[model samples]
Target: MALRDFALLVLVCMLWAGNNIVSKYVVAYLHAPPLFYAAVRFGIVALAVFPWLRSPPRPLWRLLVVSVCMGAGSFAFMFIALKTASPSSAAIVSQLMVPTTTLLSFLLLGERLSARRLFGICLTLVGALAVMWDPAGFDFSGGLAFVLVSVVMGSLGAVLMKQMEGVQPLQFQAWVGWASAAVLIPASLVLEPGGFETVFSIGWRFWAAVTFSAVVVSVFGHTAYYFLIQRYEANLISPLTLMTPLATIGLGVAITNDPFDARMAFGAAVALVGVLIIAMRPNQAMLFLFNLRNRAR
Candidate 1:
């Protein structure tokens, strides 16, 4: 990667990390309804990216499925989880996505994983569990459970996305934004009483948070990441994304004054190591697919 691209990647990670803090603040501290908050964010995104919505991608059904899984399903579960889970712990636990994606690829795509990758998956699971475990209560919290569900939704979307071709980042985001808003809006209205009222009462601060998340994090941050991944090797790009969690943890501790004990640190270290292993290993399927596309282009 060029020096400029590396810098861009770091900025993207920082923006994403800040988004975790912003989301936690919106849903937890501000007491905004999780689904409502997500709905509003995606609604803004849908409007912002509506230009790309004109030419629907082929196999519209698959696109819609992938959009819902990666969009509203993942965000709703994650925002709900954040109501109970600290940003630091949640960031560490979210590393499970790396392993979960690999496992899903093996099962759904019939992709084979090397022994090293299997070991990494096991380690990632153990580490995520460790973070979820509450020693005092002698049981895991529901927050991380919801997070696990969120990770699975996202992993499924990622696996399914491999079958999609010729979908630009903004176009995919447009679909996700519109589809997620469509689902989440009704879900929030029916499930969360007075959600709209509460959000409206919160005033401009609420809109500011939503705007930053929608425009900066969802649109710009994700679009920039897609740009980099297209230009570089997936393996090279994947490991660098670990910075997002680290930055999230740091921001959580500093901004939220989150409780981070020795156990939390250990879990984060272990999970990140596992994620690193999985990311560092070359992804033959991705490379082959991208190479073919690039040649055709």
Candidate 2:
């Protein structure tokens, strides 16, 4: 990656890290309804990017599926996890996305995985298990379980998205915003009664967080990321994006006062190393995303 691109990606990571802290605050501290928070966030994103919604991509069903998977499926579960999970732990667990994406490509896209990558996957799983270990009672963390589901959802969306063509970043965001809101709105109503009322009770603080997530994180940060990914190798980009989690860990400790003891630290290091190993090598799925624009032409 060029120095400039690296710097840009770093900024994107900072934005994402900050959003994670903001999300945890809203769901855990402010006691906002997780599903409702996600719904409103995406609803704001949909409105902000509505202009891009004009030119819908082809194979509309595929786009919609990708949107839901990446948007509502991942984020709703993540927010739910945040209701109990520390931002640091959630950030570490989300590294499972690297291994999960590779595995999904092997199963769904007939991609072959090398032995080294398989080891990386195994290591990542082990590290994730370690991070979620409740040493006190010898039980698993429920919050981390939801984070696992979120990772799988995001991984699936990324793999599916690699097969798509001619979808610009903002256009993709527009669809994701609309699709996620569509799913989350009704789901929130059914699952979290009076969610809107609770959110409304919070007033401007809720809107402020929603705006930051929608505009700063999704619109500016992610759109910038899409542009860079198109220009750079996925292997180069993937490892660098790990900065988001590291930054999240620091922010969580400082802001949220998360308990990141020795065990958690060791697990985070292991999980990140595994993710790094997976990211450093070329994979079919990453290649597909790198070549998406070329394939479209």
Clashes of each: 0, 0
- How many residue-pair clashes does candidate 2 contain? 0
Candidate 1 per-residue lDDT over residues 73-106, each given as its tens digit: 9999999999988888889988999999999999
* Reference-based TM-score of each model: 0.93, 0.91
Q: Where does the lowest 10-residue lDDT sum fall in candidate 2?
A: 284-293
lDDT of 2 by residue, 1-297 (tens): 688888999999999999999999999988999999999889999999899998787889999999999999999999999989999999988999999999999999999898768877887887777888874752335587899899999999999998998998888899999999999999999999988789889889988998999899999999899899899987778888989999999999999998888888888987887787787765643554357558768
Error of 2 at 108 (Å): 0.6
* Top-TM-score candidate index: 1
Candidate 1 TM-score over all chains jointly: 0.93
Clashing pairs in 2: none
Q: Which regions of candidate 1 deviate over 4 angstroms?
A: 136-139, 282-297
Cα displacement (Å) at residue 9, model 1 = 0.6
